[model samples]
Target chain A: MSTATFPEETRARLEVDAKEIIGRYPRQRSALLPLLHLVQSEEGFVSAKGIAFCADQLGLTTAEVTAVATFYTMYKRRPTGDFHVGVCTNTLCAVMGGDEIFAALKDHLGVGNDETTEDGRVSLEHIECNAACDFAPVVMVNWEFFDNQTPESAKRLVDDLRLGRDVAPTRGPDRLCTWKEASRVLAGFSDGRGAEGTQAGEPSLTGLRLARERGWTAPDPDRLPVGDDPEGGAA
Target chain B: MSTGTTLTPVLSDNWDRPESFTLEGYRATGGYGALRTALGMEPDALVDLVKASGLRGRGGAGFPTGMKWGFLPKDNPNPRYLVVNADESEPGTCKDIPLLLANPHALVEGVAIASYAIRSSQAFIYVRGEVLHVIRRVRHAVEEAYAAGLLGKDVLGSGFDLDVVVHAGAGAYICGEETALLDSLEGYRGQPRLKPPFPAVAGLYASPTVVNNVESIASVPSIVANGAEWFTAMGTEKSAGFGFFSLSGHVTRPGQYEAPLGITLRELLDMAGGIRAGHRLKFWTPGGSSTPIFTDEHLDTPLDFESVGAAGSMLGTRALQIFDETTCVVRAAGRWIQFYAHESCGKCTPCREGNFWMVQVLDRIEHGEGTEADLDKLLDICDNLLGRSFCALGDGAASPVMSSIKYFRQEYIDHVERGGCPFDHAKSTVWGGTA
Candidate 1:
């Protein structure tokens, strides 16, 4: 339970965004997940004020909001660094040097898992799979991928962030946003970077390149076998 | 490297282009043609075509897609919904996130077509919240579809209306299970509900709903565009159509290989340039971490649903997590069990408690402080956990443990005798050296 509350103007502005999000779902309660993200965007974490605002907006109790927020790993109860650097330590990533990257990062940054640096520039954590396994030993800064990472590369990434140097993810946006801005995007508000980076990464296109190289393509649908169920009613 | 089965890229065809995620890029490749063709026909006819195609769900469970759509009662009093499960959090299951990032329009178009077929007026794409870029790509695709008159309000002048909402899920792997997904979408803690009435009967606001994997839904557009025969012609008789075979870890060229379903791992490994230099294949997972791990001996087994099942593993999401001999089986299984223990949702006792204890036993074994009786104790714990949980998470937790021990019990014994992990951890790393 947090005693802090958002300023009056801040609460008023957040209300507008909350209402817009509430309208997206059929029922207002269904907007809780995004609403949590919206509040996270406002305060960098879901504070007591954020929970109270959500409870009021959705007509739910604070306990209900807290339960939902706590269930998710993304919503932080305390302040987070501007850039949250997560190293994927799942099975595949671990065997492929994710453990090394994570250990090196902790030592380099002088912080343990889920702890922020003294300057509040970066927070370190060992994340589960973020689904970019082909680019194993992956790192994520503010939910943007830094694929195919090694301990050395991961170190340079955090140092750049700490020094306020420009750092871009392996895929997606040309520029990286702070943690709060990323949360806003997750809450369904676009930062207009939706079409920023290349649509596909190199590994993602391996199959397409192989198919092209081998001159393999799906059979033409127009030349399909006849005398069968036209509507495919084999069920 | 020449195998009888060659690659057939449909969903992943345009991924190489820089603009593959954009509407302009997708339209150039005849992307929305399926939705246009599907919109003109009766909904029942569209469902029939899907049934004829024999397209199974690309999510871990190999349920027939058309059969899942047909389960809705004819006279549903409430609105029907199509919830796309884009939460690809399974360790080593990495296809859906990349698919969304590369070609989100495919899923958007498929959502339009499937929602119309199921008579759903509203649909939602529940993506995992961790991938911000993916969520943006998919949301942009939905926005583009709506702006192009393909999604909202009498779509393409066919008098059928649909609304697509892209919902980002807060982190929970259990939400990948469909029922838990609906609960999460409804703003509740993402825990699985008892399944007397499946999602088809009563789901998502207590109405008829069809939950589908992102890949299964994305594959719909091609099925509509190409016809059932075109799909059925590619793969085996039962496991029809092409799917993404995601190869990751310890391979010469790891990536997504979209090929016909029945292609074998032996053929795939050859195409992927075989294991890394100076390394031979050891153990691997045929699917994601949830499925049983397979050794090099099973490489020739057909990578289809039935054949993989016959070989005692599953073609789960076609996520082939390859590990070479340099990797430690005990360490791999221990890491995967920690994931399950961390993600077990605590809604059920067996999964909540069983995973906790299994982690302790495996950690002890991995550290070379266990007797041989501890291995049996681990198996005994797995027996209690398997088939007893409310969801598949427990069964999945048991998979790597039982399979790794079965294949590498001698290795476990070696760890005990050597008093620690035998393989040099630094050797398995990317740089292959200690800092």
Candidate 2:
């Protein structure tokens, strides 16, 4: 199969990026991972040509680039899609059922780890930690977040993205994060709940007092209520 | 005064207030005025101001920020890049993400100012991959700056162009290490490359680079708008400047506490509401969990780099992970070891294998399955990893491992002798079971 392609401009840019990556490493062979990332950004995989090009650009053998590319799971040595759904399966997320989300993606996308969709829309990569642990089972799609995801929400998101609908806001009915966890995360950083599994640390009066002292707080989010479920937290 | 009683000299003012995150609030409190001042001054003078302010890196190593900037070979004919390490994955470090969310402009302005000073056209904010919300907030702030003409070409008609790119990591703690962060920013597997090339001479794209912490860069605009002397007047002699301490674990306030350097934990706790009301402080990190642990006896020790170093530990990121009396030192150490094990990049043998082994020993001790010999063995393992590994992380991971044993050796022994954790039943209720 042909190596999955990216926007052509990305390919031209990867060359400069490739030289810089090679230039950073003392050993040319070490440039392989960076080269793979460059190609992935452009071609969506470290295709044979991509590997050969990187090897030639860095003055290393093709086998050299292939070695590091295959060694790390993040690099795809085959054709894949542009939009990658990264399911975080690290310990905390796993304990909170990140596995189910991974499974659901595999089932919904009809591809296992790293395999792309038939229409070349999305690929799945099982990752570790989406970082918002309190609202666990987070899947990062391209650069956007899909947190507290269940199979149903996962299906809806994939379907929406597949249909070319903007999944930007990432809220409303499909927003699976519980009211408490979602609000805490959206509310920037608060210690969430004292005894709950939420570990976002405590809030303070330094900023609270300064805002009040300077009269900078109230009119800012003028109409937004302080205790509202999910509004001012949106930046 | 930017000291106590609700004063914010620059970015962090009003962060405790409900709507302080809005652009309107940040604008009302003299936010972008620094950017205007920075735009007025020559980039060289801003660098001069920072150099005079004596600001140091807040990402553990505490390298002088101005000195680090000066390290870039100005006449070397290579494009310099400023990469902000927003990857706050250190075991007890929670300050940066909160800071970014609260005042993204602090970093955005810093990035803009640093990029101009360094003559870099592009800047990248490499955040912890896990902080999706924060990444979003920062990105939004960058967009806001660009819209306001604070970023991009000819900022406020200064005829200089800079682009700020907010990139997220795959959540590796190792990436916080300067060289590793560069590797990740360059879009690789996020491993630490060899140093001495040290991101100044040969960094991101084999050019001059500055890899600074979120707090370090965020502290810049103030030093720029306010004179260097104004910046210097707050803290002690060497470590002059305000700092953000991520006070977590058993602390009463348990959040990001921003204050000048040289403040004592007693003073900090007095500000933080004091040890969860009833509990007395037992163990804590003067910086993050990576630094050596400090006891209550050291409460009055100044938190500046010179003083902390005089007291035997570098004044690292100043992420104070406070543990009160009810918390078991062994369990806390065990939990920290688990984080190190999970975060160890596994590139070097000593950190990769050593952290895993320490976790196993610590796990056994935590679950009532350890022997007395294991305590010594734990110390032995940490000693090997301290300077043996490739990066500072191994050295950092070894710090807590060694200190927990140093100050609380008897605690480890007590856990082993009892065949279980001493505070399991007593303290589990405090955090409501997870401890």
Candidate 3:
């Protein structure tokens, strides 16, 4: 019987990660999270095969890997859209009418929680808290945090996202720090505010004067580099 | 009654003048001096001191801040990480955002000190994707820390290196859970991670990580500046420390009330000038919406973990979302259930589907269409979903529904029995404006 073998490159990436589990842990399961990251990064998603791969790499049973993956929020067992939209439906944001925001996105994009858009452009997941209580009623599109979001804003956002419109410029995203100045605006409102997604004119997005001053990145959406013509320089 | 403390400062306690956020201002306020002092101490000793302090997580879960730091494996090649959960999205949990806005440096310094203790050269303060302004402020603080040599390589020449990166979530509530947060930080969709190997064991970048709430980390400076005994002296034993109780929703002075942890809600209400004029207490959340709901009956319950827990609720995130008699219990529960429903990251069935179903039932009841069976259905679903989810969100989402129904079933019954809300009809439309 003939058996398939992993390519050398794939084999190298698949090498044992005992380093993550070594030394005085309760068990081999301690390395589950790291193993999951490795498997997910290599496979782009955690399939049964990926779980097996993690199990093999970590010297653990497949059941253990599956259990760890099943345990955490970060591990995605299924395929998701390129741009994931996590709508906050917790205390602060929910009171502010995040319901309308979630509904508008669902209606506008034709996707509910965990279901990707028909075109696979976005996946909408209703999430508990994104931690920006000050900016209740917020949605995370891709990696950038858009605050004080309204249904109308969500509509514009979802629409622009579908069309692949330009992303608004943001500040300090490069540095990886929380924008403290936005709290001033967040403080302007109170809790139990906004019942459904956001007020008709709310989810006030732009923050602090400095944020506006610094330009932001829209995260270029070019799927393949081959299509664009370098009219000005490439030739 | 008032320290007359003044609302001038938002968060920059030790750095901004009133602790201003400016670089020069931070320098003047004895900012990096603590980092300098900390650098001279053996890293493990700092960890030990923190553990001795018995400081619990302040963001919400109240994990022992010091004990959490001690959990990092001392001998490991893996890069340990420190993540500050600045996604203060809890209802009535407004302290962190405001504190970060007013005092980003406090968190930054705390991060730096914490990084040094855990020997983690890399740290990330995971902010909520929203609150762009606070994100910017934290970035500025990080920039300041880097410039002052408090962050970046060999911080203060302690031979310890740390990089404080501020990664914002794509704005999902579940990301606040340390594991879900680690997932979000790794650039995945945000959802909660089941515990057992809490972030202390494996976290950011899948390395040994210390995930702390913003308040938990921010309190470090004070803890370090003073002593554990000083901190413990204030709050009751087993719940030792100070905390920021956010007073909102019809409070006379709706803001953060920083006091010893054991202080009762009655005292906090007094500090906040009591509920808004002519408004008496109805029901409220002791922490964010997750912990069980409390009412005027619980006003005197000591706002400590043990006391609150003993009273059948958690002192989670101390976000007092107070309501008054004017508010409708059914309507309020419906609104809160709507939040849990919408935010239920659906990885598990109970939260994702359960919250949605609960909201539907509550909506019918709120709209005077619900039957008594709906309430039973709500309870039944909650029983199945609570503690059955992949993360605590399921439990949190069911908290208000279960607690509200327990305390105010008649209010729900009244809605269904009367065929209309007995409370203000004016407010019913307010909640329904979403459609």
Candidate 4:
């Protein structure tokens, strides 16, 4: 492993961002994760320069910073493609078609897990549980969910990404951006795309909808004993 | 019992409303009414109210919420902290992410109420990093709360000042554990710390901290708004109040079912339109993949902390991952074991080594290379890893394997005998397959 330094211009920009991130925490060491993300946003992955930058900003040794950076799965150690396509291959999703989707994508792209395509358009990996089980067989591009996915749909999604065609998530912003832009947002810098939309799926709101239909409410102090039944009426 | 059950949706009540994530919409829907009510009362009294309400922690461990809150030191010179474990990484647990995404203000409001009750000024919501959309929604909600004087200094005209930071965790399932989450928040490898100086005493910068789950904190506003007795009246004696029961996998309506803790799977299955179209329920997890798998016979087992435990599994996160007859039990268990193997932090020997060996055996079993001796080896390894590991992650790793072997040993035997899975792969298509 060789040590490298960030460019002066890059270092200057990161210093400002690093200061802002460190300001959020009581102890400056706590900002190490976000700072690594910040540097990763600039570079494709956690370069030798990124680790050095994080260490310099947090007043920690490179070894200390490297340990934290390597421990987390998000921070890439090497250059990745523009679109990081992660298909959920956990239990529910795999059983639903995540396995097939992953297999198909690997064949379609002619690249294995964590491998970038020849065009550098997409990098594919099998992610564990994006926490959208209801929308099983979810394929996430740049961390935006492409829910209820199949092998064909997922392949089409990556194809569109590679062709520079417009792509939208199942329930996200109007359009999808490159993986770098998503990383910047995850680094605590908003891309002004925050206000696009923030609606959950219909499945997510099922309980609330069912409750409303039945006129079921949490027991109110003032309206106690208003209903004949102690338990709210069955929906 | 009625075929259809009415659920008192506490955390998810405002999920369907438009702009529910916004402060204005939340206020319109009587959100933060609890924070206001809680602000008027003494913090200790609020704690007592939660204690009397019997609100247990919704983060899988059914520990009493108020008791956990009360564990914090009363007169610590260092600032006491309130850390919300929004790291909803349990495989089948899907409620918290949706809760934060749809109605983030509910969690924001809950954070406010909890911070005040615990007398903590600084709080952090350690959300999983993969869900960028959820993180954005929560950040936007926090910004809204701050602008409306709901957060920051002297909240809601009350003298209580609090600041909430929404921190995103780089993908690690162990971070879902409270201690590991604290370490992650402190910018270290997300590994579980030994107890004794639990988060309540020395956590996050060596101060007294109260780490509550996303759902647990989100449920606080409702508990405070509607008195303790009101909240207590819902669930069973041991487990009180409504909780988000995440129904996923083969269920017809795989969604968050916010019902009382004592509700049975039979009733939930009915509500979910029963295992897809016509498939019969096979083995299922009452909680996430971590809890012991249950079968059709246990459908009537109440999903409370006590009943589920009595039925031989913890009421873990209420992540009911339903599997139908078409699914392969061995294959599913193997997948779960692989997750545990992948997520093992490599801190403790049992978890680190045991899960690795289990996955190898499980893979062999699933791929038709396993023998009867592999079954004995699997059980032996699970026994070593069960309660002997450093944290619950080790124990969780062994659960699906142990439970599957317990209930569906024949399935394992059949795999060995047949040299392959018995279930047809075509029947378990991701979509366009008959139930």
lDDT of every predicted structure (CA atoms): 0.91, 0.66, 0.65, 0.86
- lDDT order of candidates, top first: 1, 4, 2, 3
Cα-based TM-score, every candidate:
0.97, 0.71, 0.67, 0.97
Cα lDDT of model 1 overall? 0.91
For each candidate, give the interface RMSD after superposing the true interface residues on Cα. 2.0, 11.5, 17.8, 2.6
Candidate 3 lDDT tens digits, B1-435: 112121111132332133355556666666666677778888888888788778898877777877888887766677787878887766557677656655677789888888888877777777775555566567767777788777788877777788766654433567777788777556345666767667777676557988888888877776676666655555656787667666655555555556667777787676566776665788888888888888889878888888899988899988877767666777777777777665667789877888888888888898899899998898999999978988888888788888998998888889888998887533212133221
Q: Mind giving the per-residue lDDT tens digits that candidate 4 earns over B1-435?
A: 323456877777777777877778888889888888989999999889888888999999988889999999877899999999998999898888888887888889888988898899999999899988888888989998899899999998898999989898889999999899999999999999998788899999999999999888888888787777677677876787889888888877788888987898998887777887867888888889999999998988888988889889989989888888888988898888888889999999999999988988999988899998999999999999989876899999889998999999999999999998888855666574574
Model 4 is docked with a DockQ of 0.58
Candidate 3 regions with alpha-carbon error over 4 angstroms: A1-235, B1-19, B425-435
> TM-score of chain B, per candidate?
0.98, 0.93, 0.93, 0.98
If both were scored by DockQ, which would come out higher, candidate 2 or candidate 4? 4
Over 4 Å off, model 2: A1-235, B1-9, B16-25, B429-435
RMSD of 4: 2.6
For residues B272-391, what per-residue lDDT tens digits would candidate 2 score against the true structure?
678766567887788776788899878888888878887767678776766666667776676667767777777899989999999898889877899988988988998799899878
- Model number with the top lDDT: 1
User: What is the C-alpha lDDT profile of model 4 across A73-188, one tens digit per residue?
Assistant: 99999898999999988888888788889999999999999999989989999999888998898999989988888899998999999999999888777899777787778788
- Model 1 alpha-carbon drift over 4 Å, by segment: A1-4, A224-235, B1-3, B433-435
| DockQ of the two-chain complex in candidate 2 | 0.08
